[model samples]
Target: MNIKLLAVGKTDNESLQKLIDEYIKRLGFYINFNLEILPDIKNAKNLSEAQQKEKEGELILKKIQSADVLILLDEKGKQYTSEEFSGYLQKKMNSGAKQLVFVIGGPYGFSDEVYKKSSGKISLSKMTFSHQMVRLFFVEQLYRGFTILRNEPYHHR
Candidate 1:
């Protein structure tokens, strides 16, 4: 199955973007992976937190198709070990999902609409992370998950 990561705004840090790109490249060996960055909302300074989430949510929902499995990267979501995550991915692939879309919401987090649209949620950790950093972390974990599934040395190293 094809896997897609949808995140709001651009990753401005050169270091972070480089690392995120590296993991994306490695992930290509395992699955059709795409990282799509949605443009940031204009005039966001004038909007309330809820308004910003609503606007971001609209952009997020627009990218999703009815058949896509939507998973939100959220703090309050289910947490899993690396091996368990690999199993989770295996189940999705076996289930014959066309695409698994995971989202990293904007600074203020997701809107009610976005939450409602999600099929599930996953938490990398209980600790908070910058949205940009989360991009790197999530991709790296994805790469690691594949390596673990294949019994590659990358997981132990």
Candidate 2:
């Protein structure tokens, strides 16, 4: 199955972008992967928190196909161990999904519409993280998951 990561805004920090790129490249060896960055909302300063999430949600929904499995990276979502996450990845692959779309929403998080459309939600940690930083962390974890699946030496356990 193809894995796509859709996130709002660009990773402006050169160092973070470089690391995110490296993990994306590593992920390509195991499966089809793509990182699509949705441009940040314009005039966001004037919009309310709800308005911003709504606009960002629209852009996110536009990219999703009906058949794609949408997973949101939400703080209140389910948390799993590394091994368990690998199992989750295996199950998605086994289910024969055409594409697994994971989204990292904008500053105010997702809208009600976006929440309704999601197949499930995953929490990387209980602590909050910057949207840009989450991109890197998620990709690195994805790479680690694949390595665990393949019994590669990349993951210690």
TM-score of 2: 0.98
Q: What tens digits encode model 1's per-residue C-alpha lDDT throughout 58-152?
A: 99999999999999999999999999999999999999899999999999989999999999999999999999999999999999999999999
Judged by whole-model lDDT over C-alpha atoms, candidate 2 comes out at: 0.96
Each candidate's root-mean-square deviation in Å?
A: 0.6, 0.8
TM-score of 1: 0.98
lDDT of 2 by residue, 84-105 (tens): 9999999999999999999999
Misplaced by over 4 Å in model 1 are: none
Q: What are the models' TM-scores? A: 0.98, 0.98
